[model samples]
Target: MRQWRLAAALIAMPALALAAPCELKIGAMGPMSGSGAQWGLSMQSAAELAAAEANKAGGIKINGETCKVSVVSYDSKYTADGAAAGANVLAGQDIHIIIGPVGSIENAAVKPVAARNQQLAWNAAYANNALEPRFPLMFQVSPPPAVWADLLIKRAMKTFPMKTVVIVVPNDQTGTDVAGVDAAAYKHNGVTATTEFFQRGTTNFAPIITRVLATHPDAVDTASSAPGDAGVIVKQLRLAGFTGPIGRVGGPGTAEILRVSGGLDVLRDFYWYEAVPTDDPKVRAIDDEYRALLGKDPMGGTTFWSYLPGARLTLKAVQAAGTDDAEKVAAVLRTMPVEDPNIGKGYWTGKKQFGIAQGLFFPFGIGIIKDGKNLGVERQEAQPE
Candidate 1:
């Protein structure tokens, strides 16, 4: 009887190991297609790199055992319904932590579903209520306009003066949240600002460009439009003989913007926001590391670099917590220091704004293009929100 019991117990041990494989799955979601594809792809790329780093180091230590880290990516399409479906999909797979949905509406949709599913998500959205106290698991990917927009506007005006500006964006939550803040920043700097909106997926921006030019503003700002849409607007603006300075106070997509806007000649006298210190050698090394590990060049744009710290820190937290459970991970994440090897020192802010000190604040960057000259990017400390 004793020999038979020992054999049955030995068989059950294998079944238990099969039930929980020696692997950790990290979930990544974003708009992986369309004009906004760059932003979502950046998130996916960042997560993939973080996982690769962990796996290369023999994976993260969970419960005293090294488990391989693998990334599962999803295209949330930057929509509420899309994000909801994505959250359900990841949750169904027993994924308790996620990194993505880089738009205001998508984050709004994701938070509720993540909460219901007892999952934790980090969103790169700049919406007003991106990180609420109620959703302790929801964390901001980076600081919003209120933290860096004022300085960016000041620098831009110093480089290229503007008395009036017209900001164009999509007629969606992402547009609304960014346009309002960008306009406020412009106004605070004593520049009169007006806003215009176009439905998402409007390929031809001639009508809006005409409306923008009719105002005869000193500059037209592509506040937070997708890089693709912003590029078309810049192209049309140049074609319309609008030679004044152009501004981009939204997301990082200067590479894509330049491609769409017909390069430096057309995008002359441009001032925009960047999220990483591209000029720093340490920061630039990330590109080399990414290419070396992934065997391909990084998805272009500073968003990918900016998104890295969050993903890296999350993995570190998983190692420290020794578990993938959302609540435990959140607790470990809160106590962990905000630091990245390439990006350097940062802090966890958002206590005043979101009632939780969960937002990631790192040094930001501002880029300039003057008279077809690429002046590189300048780094600035991200103030506490």
Candidate 2:
């Protein structure tokens, strides 16, 4: 009888290993509506793709059980209060990792709430104070303007010479801070910069365009303004007969700008910064990987590719930590080498300005359109100068 019982117990051990899998929840966040929708959706798409990839590969392993990766998303409505609300909502769901809250306002509001909830969040905020040593759990997702604005401005100057520039941005912390950095870059290159601000929700920009034209700037830069707003500004500026090169030193929205500004003909002589080298074969293949995992076409533009590596790295940290605890995951993230299968190797930089070496620095791209001709994006290696 004892030998029979031992034989039954040994046979049942295999069944225990094959039990139901657990769930590993990760949160995706950003503004999912209104003008800033494109940026937020990109973060969400990247998060979904990463989770799908992890699930396809047998999910995340915690303890001895295989856990299926799940993504929860929130739309912060492009406001500080929205992000704070989203953080609390995700925390209520027991989510310990969050992927975004794209703008400066959103990031600032969400950081404290996330820290209080013991959550690790990667933000796409380009604000001056986006990263701080005090919030060890908060990380900057992409290289900010201070990191590459000089290179972008120098390259744009090569294509379109200018002694003075007017940057149009929304009246907000992100707008003001980004414009300040971009203005410094222009000043360093011997070009005087003046910033023009508009209310966040004004549809028609004729008045502001008139004000911007009064300065007679050689070029106009839509620095950190939403794509819809930038397009309107570009359209109105062209209508106002200011036929100067339009440059965007803030975020990646060339496609949206073109669409809103009536395509390349209207946006002729345009130069801007793209978050990623969208033309590279290896980089373009990121979409193919997305299709393989998500079974859908990619959404948004450069941000989808740009945000992917951060989401991948976050999950990698979760796996390395062997648990979803924010502190443990953050510890693993700080120690792990910055690299992504899609975006390739990156750097753990941001100490000079932010006082924390937690920002992810990746190679960026410069895009140009000259006289109605599309001149594809050129890759710029990440030089942490």
Candidate 3:
């Protein structure tokens, strides 16, 4: 009887050892097919990179078992209908953690689906104040417009002493919301600001440029303008003889703007709200890895900094909570300090503004483009109003 039992145990040992590790699927939902395809693709790429790194390091540990991370992405086309469909698809795949639905309009559509599924969503785009109260599980990892706007205005005032500013943004809801926040920030900083909206897909910015320059403002604030629109506006503004400061308040689009502007050196002296400091060892390492994997530098936007760091923070929270449970991970995220290479050490904020501590409050990097290269010069911490 003893010999028989030993043989049976030895047979079962192989099966136990060969058991497959639990798979953790992370959903990346964004505009993977529209004009903002670069944004969505970058988000997907960053999340994949993070997952690949974790897998290399033996993946996430839970209950003494290893969980392999996988990022499953879906294209939302930057629309409400598309976002809803994408959310449903991700939910069907049993993905509990979603990276985006990039714009506010898309996120608005995704909120219900996320709430219904009880999924933890990290908003990779700008923080829409309206979404937080309704969707408790949705968290905004990017700094809110209020935070970045404050920094932009301060830097503009100190460097150029601007008094009157003209804000131009897309005619969509996201643009309207950002313009409001930027207007408030400018007002608080002792600057008068006016806003002009342009329809999405308006390639010719001459009319808008003429009208904006006619205002005789000290600076033109492109508050959260789409990458293509921003490039055209900058190019036209320079061509139209507007020499004052141009606030690229909508994160750095250095490469895109340069490409769109026909390499015209239009972004010189622009106050960009974010840029990866090339001098930082961590930033360089990430860039190197990204270039190696993607065969190109990260899109000239927040992708390099936002998604990768957000992924790192999410995994850290999962490790801390000891499970992939959304509530458990969220609880850990609320108290965790994010020390990623992109945003640096910071805590989750936004209780006063959004009635939830879901926004990542970190030092915003302000940089300038000189001779066609972005160089991070100053860092501003988010201050309470």
Provide the overall lDDT of each model, using Cα atoms, as 2-decimal numbers: 0.88, 0.89, 0.74
Q: Which residue segments of model 2 deviate by more than 4 Å?
A: 1-20
lDDT of 3 by residue, 1-385 (tens): 9999999999999999998869889888787764466567767877777777788778887766789899898988877798888888988988878878677778888888888987888765564564476677788756667666776678667667888999998888778888888888889999999999998768898988989988999989887776667878988998889888788776555556667766636676577666344345655577677676546666425555655677778887887787877778888877776567655666667777777778766555676655444555566655443
Ranking according to lDDT, highest score first: 2, 1, 3
Candidate 1 residue-wise lDDT, 1-385, digit = tens: 9999999999899888777658888888989988888898988889889999999988988788899988888898778899999999989988887988788889999998999998888898888888899999888778877677889999999889989999999999889888999999999999999999999989998998889989999988898898988999999999999999999998788888898879999999899988777788888888889999999988746789889899999998899999998899999999988888998889898887677788899887899999999998998976544
Q: Score residue 207 of candidate 1 by CA lDDT.
A: 90
TM-score of each: 0.94, 0.94, 0.85
| Pick by TM-score: 2 or 3, better one | 2
In model 3, residue pairs whose N, Cα or C atoms come closer than 3 Å (at least 3 residues apart or on different chains), thus clashing, are none
lDDT of 2 by residue, 1-385 (tens): 9999999999999999887669998888998887788888888988999899888878887776779998898999899999999999999999989999799999999989999999999898899899998899998888789988999999999999999999999899989999999999999999999988988878988889889999999999998998778888999999999999999999997877888889999999999888878888898898888888888887767788898888988888888888989999899999988887766677888899898988888888999999999999998877553
lDDT of 3 at 243: 85
lDDT of 1: 0.88
Clashing pairs in 1: none
Q: What TM-score number comes out for model 3? A: 0.85
For model 3, state the Cα shift of residue 113 in Å. 1.2
